[model samples]
Target: VMRANYRKILVPITEEAKKLKIFKGEPLDLNEVSNLNTIVEIRKLIKNNQAKIEYLVENKAKKKQAAIYLLTKTKVEYQEILKGLRKTAKKQQALLDNIVKKYHEYPKFGSKIVSELDVSSSVLRTAVKKGWLVKKEQEIYRDPLKDFESRKQKNQIKLNSEQTHALNSIGKSIQKKEAKTFLLEGITGSGKTEVYLHAISIALEQKRNALMLVPEISLTPQMVKQVKERFGDNVAVLHSGLSEGEKYDEWRRIRRGEAQVVVGARSAIFAPLKNIGLIVIDEEHESSYKQNDTPRYHARDVALLRSKFHKCPVVLGSATPSLASRARAQKGRYELLLLTKRANQKSLPKVDLIDLKTVEFTGAQFDLSIPLVDAIKEKIAKKEQVILLLNRRGFASFMLCRNCGFVLKCPNCDISLTLHKDTQQMQCHYCGHKEPIPRKCPKCQSEKIRFLGTGTQKVQEELEKLLPEAKILRMDVDTTRRKGSYKKILDGFGDHKADILLGTQMIAKGLDFPNVTLVGVINADTALSLPDFNSAEKTFDLLTQVSGRAGRAEKTGRVMIQTYNP
Candidate 1:
């Protein structure tokens, strides 16, 4: 008697939206956003006599669960698909529109007893369901769940409604894109990584391989750790950091199908992984993606083209996503998923810029901003680590003739020669031209000479004089040119063995440190004041990233940026 009021209904949703979200035997709005029009359409279908909910089911066998909500019942079947399924299934079916749905999970099997006089009952009773029961079990197909680690592996990911919808839709569109290209542009700290991981899992389940790329080597270890932790041994690492033999072995493993996924810096785009189903690029807008050497190519652009060649999709992730990616998403060239929240217990650091223009440090032979010195001392007293970021290296920028005001210049190139007090030599940073310290100026033979401008080495020396007990480590090509020197330096700072970490542009990408509370920008103006169009952007990203290093976990953190322009 209650089934009489359960008149069948149908709802309207975008065809594209429907094609990706719905699954077989799945309720309407399964993965789609519910709307007023959808509700009204369903309600109208329930109110009309022309609509029959039972006819919505293509097969009477699968319609047994249709009894829960009559309003959502429709004459349409779930046409969305997963990999290797038809690109899109748009054929309409409203014949079994009278059926209602069942809300209970794991319904009990019932006998086919129905009253002969009831038309609907008689129709359902004679449908003769033929599937879902095991007829002949095969022993070879049976296996213990403990045999595979994946069977016991935990599902750590918790997706929001939008992410769930995206997964369902993306699964359905895989087979449809034999000729189509798709991109995912998500913002900073956004769970963009999870989305890509979800997609990669699907690709692997389909017996295909995947690829991922990041911009900087500094960020690779963190990513590699995450991927390896998630995917296990099936993952391989590749990048300039690896030995040639190691890279070649990884490439071979990729081509032979031994490794299903490879993650690395820009060059990994050419990893030669076959049957590629997905490609993910983290920090897609980074300039590091562009190859500066000959046969130059942009990693992101190349990844897109490679994905096209393989008929796969690309997932591009960034906290501060690049303008190009944003533009593509705006133009509908890529699907945009916004994960505005940080992954775990983390927060963006507070940035405090100390203007150096007004601070008087000129009392000495050469001036260092007083606010910066104070901040350093304050951080030291508080027992929190500090990082002094500068973009230049060398003891001093140049040597000068105080008597004649003549500056020393490089002989080979028309550039100033930097003074290296540690070695008592004047060297051209560009051409490597070096000469012993002269008693008199080369030009006017004046004996009065002064070293001009501070560099990384000078900063290290000054900090020693100011904070004698502080452990200082400098990281740059100059100090880390040896094989494992970079790793040694990073280890020292990472373990809190070093109280102060100072360097050129090497340490700014995304070094996660928990104890770093004070990030001091020795000279923010160095990069911004450089003669380059992208200087501002590079400086901004670097500054923001460095500041992020402070106060990452629980303990409060602050940043002191001392710049001439503040």
Candidate 2:
């Protein structure tokens, strides 16, 4: 009779929403909401018929569990079996004794002793066959917390008024289980990350995990260090840069509920985490969040769905947010949090633009203007570090012949070949095709060939020639292609081992160098002239972010932008 009545009733949900599998193969429970239209339509249909309706609300909570090995019986209970085995198994007594010793160490789980047994000796197989040993899978607690041996407890920071207000609002949502989205728009060095860490602490206090998405793998080392310093082994890092084995292990950690905090790039949004209390998208405006392939998913949108499902808060933080996010924030869709003041109370850096059309060239190289070179020299004389930004890599952009106006080009690509000075080869950045650096133009066969255009490699060479005593660490795709090279270069620069840090746009953001008082932009118009509308916006962001790296300490920083467009 109950089954017949259940078939007469109807409930429906959206296809995508139903994919969550919250309601399946049963009458809709009162705890779950059904569509109002469906309920109203069903009532009208049943009005003329003899039918009764009953509603019941029952709260059901289930504990999540994972498979773990446990002993079939206690070590004390196994003594009788060992006594029987000692008589029947004469040669297997040694292996049996070792297994007995291992059980004494970890009596709750027998799989812990599986590795200690040499199954090739046939003792463990014999014992299992004789009912002396049993392998049983049971529910076990998964503990993700691990002790970091050398980490020093960081001193607690006093939040400024602005940070305090943002924290209070964000924490309120968590405490009330209200799913909300916040756009944390702050200027460079305005303590956005500090707000994120503190909010994550609150989520942990609520006994929930947090998921943080960063844009690049290069940014992971610094972020992992910070989170580990705070939460230790409760954190798991995911990114393409990790080995397959490492990725699997980290995924298992999250799936088994061993990791309460997940920090990763785009793919991390889908981490197998349950009851996530918070989701953070650092640098939310970055284009990296948009997946270009099939099953296309944006990290921000995924965060929203996850937040809605778990009744948590999502924080989108960036100094320069994307237009779509900023527009949403302008509306009532997302709550906006602003951090206008610098955390350290330091003044913003001074910016100076040198018009390359009018400025004097330095040492016959058009790449470095005289004023910019003077500023670098001045900073080095004061023993302060410097960072030079040139978005291009390789030694020279192209090789050109003076006589016939012939240019070297890649065989497989329409783009010109780039000269790598260190490798003495012309490489195609697009297709990885490489050839010997030609002494003369291939088309004209003229010896009067010149390497034209500027790259980070060329800039580094010019700096070496001009500033002979300056220790320059060049970081780009070429220098940092090897694993751990990025961290090594940054660490060397942070330790004051290098006087100048030169790199491409990868060095533009997420780097804080206090001793760097001078930031020189060799070519500000590189991205500005691209055939894209957002070229101007990207150029502005790169300039602003790179300039923020300097003068972060007690020093006053200066920026000299050498540009043809002024």
Candidate 3:
């Protein structure tokens, strides 16, 4: 499997590279800096007739010529560090308790009680202690407050019948401490969160930990809130949006066992949860689960691997599973559990296509075609809300020179640069290359450079112009960059504060607006227009998902998807 190969390769590299201790290679020449006490142990552990190392590592170590050297600071036992901290935490907690009691008894005498527990000389010593923990500006504790939390947590929740069955089936097939992949094909409005919580409850019952992976930045908050509401402070959340120090703290929490359930975006899969029992990947089919950067790990795949390592289970929940995952389910590799009908048992949305080819417009170059505009007007007049989706974010897809038909393109990318009308600049969505839009086209000397194609900004602006009385809102990346933007927009949407929400793919997936009678896709062509093997799949999935968002409420919604080739 892809995971097995990575574990056999990356683990050795991670361990070896971090220690700078070369295995099956020559020792680092520490002769020049002669304070070296290098002890090279090259005893080849080969059992039976097989000539290989014991670690199941793919790179076989040479027997006679292997030069394995140990560095002075190579390995540190986790138990030793914990033992020391446990002692310190005991002392500190005792001191804090005594001080707290004294303050309660004599509120004014708190200063006097504090002086009694002071380590007067500690203020002078350890000014030069050079250690990883010290370098991180962390206090060396007997038992840190965070650590105490994990150790002292006692509340264990009981599972329901459905949850118990899920656990037992998954528990058996999952093989703990190894990779067990299970797809929980639950409905959007189903209690999949509760199922995940119950599985995690089982993990905690076994004294193992759990990691929940979310596929998007926007999804993290809601998931985190749900997990926190259930597990209290036993959760640590991580995402690309967090700062380095925030990530460091969350990592430490996992390592220290202070965090039992880690809710994060993708990378939470690699969380060093000592003995992981369950891994829950929400929105498993999401492309966000795949890492575009090097070490190209898929969080969902990694979670499956980690589950195998612990011989546990992995739950991949999505309304619409990817074809590959569905195929696996069909092959019996994954136990297919379906929560097909909506919890409320309402009908799914009625999807219709508005062929843009039949519509003719005179001065209209933006996203909304005549039929779509008519549909939006019809929905608004009926007192029902609408949602318009345009995948690309900026104000315009690209700037074009009317004189020579020259399209503005990014210097670093293989794509056209987007025109950010708000910023008066052209920005490369790929490399983030940005420059002010020239008054005259560089190549053609044409001042009449036109912003072409459609985007979220252009759609929102045109909608506002067309429907003057309608309260239209936009929720793409640019508008939601600030903290709490997703929540704020979601709240606004829930309250029906906006008549319509015009956005990119962010508004897709599992958002339900009961009053939203109409869901419109300005360009169905954008999704299918991709030049990839998964084009048809992407088109179908996106089209289906966006349609799913409409009729989630009792109103029995309608969706109008406009396509150029319709």
Top-scoring candidate (lDDT): 2
The superposed Cα distance between candidate 3 and the true structure at residue 6, in angstroms, equals 29
Clash pairs, model 2 backbone: none
Candidate 1 worst ten-residue window by lDDT: 137-146
**Residues 1-566 of candidate 3: C-alpha lDDT, one tens digit per residue:** 01222121112223343353433342232222233232222112122221222233232211122111111121243233434554555544443344334433422222333366553323212211423112112232111113112324444645445555666776664344446677878655555666787777777877878888877776665666556767877888777666444565666777889888888888777777887778888778889888989989888767766666677778888877899999999999988876655655677777778777776542366456777778778888988888888888988788888999988888888689998888888899989999998789999797988877778887777777777899988988999888557767876877888889888888877575678878898888897878888887877767776777776667877888888777
**Candidate 1 Cα RMSD after full superposition onto the native fold (Å):** 26.6
Pick by TM-score: 1 or 3, better one: 3
Give the poorly placed runs of model 3, Cα more than 4 Å off: 1-168, 171-179, 360-363, 369-371, 374-384, 512-515
TM-score between candidate 3 and the true structure: 0.69
Candidate order by TM-score, highest to lowest? 2, 3, 1
Quote model 1's TM-score.
0.65
- lDDT (Cα atoms) of all candidates against the true structure: 0.65, 0.80, 0.67
* Candidate 1 regions with alpha-carbon error over 4 angstroms: 1-199, 345-347, 360-368, 421-425, 435-439
Q: How well does candidate 2 score on lDDT at residue 502?
A: 95
RMSD of 3: 13.1
> What is candidate 2's TM-score against the reference?
0.74
Please tell me which predicted candidate would have the highest TM-score against the true structure. 2
TM-score (all chains, Cα) for each model: 0.65, 0.74, 0.69
